[model samples]
Target: MPRIAEARDAAAPSSTEQHARVGRILEAAAELAAENELERVQMNEVAKSAGVAVATLYRYFPSKTHLFVAVMLDQIDRMREKFARRTRPESSARDAVHDTLLQVVRALLRRPLLSAAMIQSNSMAKAAAVPDTARVDRNFRQLLYDAAGIERVTERDAALLRLLVHSVFGIIQSCLNGRITVPDAESDLRELCDLLLAEWPDSFTPAG
Candidate 1:
């Protein structure tokens, strides 16, 4: 029993350490991408900043795009965590969802470089057929699900959320591409959110 207990304790730290190492690498990549374009970031520099060997970095993230995609995935996880603990505004579900998504858009647009890098990374992942891209898709779908104020999603709910997410993605990209002003984009999106989510339960609140 003592031997089994010792093994479990030892294995726990290994898992924690793995998570820590990955966090450090992602942080380094984010910091580097903050100061440079996505194409400008190099893996060697990230490894140096992360205090890991270049080969170690490559083992975790085989390419620059994979690193950026993982960074973006981490960011989305953070956003979900934030929303999970936040208070629901005392408004209709539509209004609350509108406000939630508007806040997310404003925050993301503040770091246009990082946002573009994330988009680029996802595109590269898709083109390269990176397995992690599937995880990104799942997380993104969850983001939309949470935004729609559904604690438990059904197929119909998921389908609606998927459409809403795609719409939001297209609008945000349009804003990024300079085809739409930020203010216009925000207004248009909020309006669309209000319209589409009008039928959502008025009693619904953020899960937190």
Candidate 2:
């Protein structure tokens, strides 16, 4: 089969029952990954834990990487919902940027192990995995824009925002993997957001 066809097949949507089964499998995977490293979690164990057969698990997630990627997709969906429910203050864009990025920092830090697994899979994501990663990345970038309190972004601002996002991810991953302390990463994210969003509109009143 062609690469495009294969990619589509790999990322194809599941039926309702299939979706529930996949969710259960991912939950099981999350539980295992939270307690053990990626390599230490076995497919058989996940199936047993999810109360599904190994063959069924395989149909849902052919490999551990795919399983983790699906979990990451779920994570991003949650992050999307968060932004949707978040009430933006009548504050300056700069403040919005600061508060929003800080939200990302706090959320990811709360589940270090689970986030670590997702990050690991992302770092190793291949062509077949691009669709899953792409959706996650798109949702992430959208969240940043929503946080900026800007419905329309100029060409230059969009480019700059993308760059800022990449930098923030690097810093957070470093902290998640223990290459740097959380405080350092948080400080860097704050500074980075401030620098990039310096042009954020300042005309605003505090929301009462």
Candidate 3:
């Protein structure tokens, strides 16, 4: 009986160890995702990169949609932390907002294939149930609130933010399609931000 119990114990890891292993696998998937499209990033590839079996990968993420969403959320969380660190009470709100938007744009540009894959995946029936758009809306609102000190941002302001975000997304897509140079895109974004914010000082209010 003691030998059997020992064998069972050997087969199971402590909860702490299990969490650590999951962390490692998620990290490995993120690294792989930096270079591969979300759809093309298979469980086998994640398992191989993570030094785990395909079953192990599935234990962490049961489907490609799950894995892809997890990866995007992880990346967004990291960016949120970075944005929080870079933004300060003393920083010009416009400059802070501009920097935050540019950082997001650069991240999307760095993983263009992954971005395209995510967009395509969202169009499929299986992807319809994912809370991606809700998460994105929450994230963008939080970023704007924190960076711009506009907690009660008006409907007009929210609409403007959406437009800016979509325009920036389009610019990155255009650059990825070889229609515009990165430098030109960057300059245009800065110009756009400046034009948008030029008249905002008169109406802007600091968050309480």
List, residue by residue over 48-157, the lDDT tens digit for candidate 3: 87788887766566556555555555566777888777626465666667777777777878877766544444333132344453565567557766777776777877
Cα displacement (angstroms), candidate 1, residue 121, comes to 1.3
CA RMSD for every model? Answer: 8.4, 4.5, 9.1
TM-score of 2: 0.83
lDDT of each: 0.72, 0.74, 0.64
Off by over 4 Å in 1: 1-14, 204-208
lDDT of 2 by residue, 29-102 (tens): 88888888777888899999998999887765666767787788787777778778968787777777777778
TM-score of each: 0.83, 0.83, 0.71
Error of 3 at 207 (Å): 4.0
Candidate 2 vs candidate 3, lDDT winner: 2
lDDT of 1 by residue, 1-208 (tens): 0001110101111577777887889899888887778778888899999998998877777667667777888888888889878776667656766777787788778888788787777755553345566667688777656655667666866676667767887787888789999999988988887777666787554456
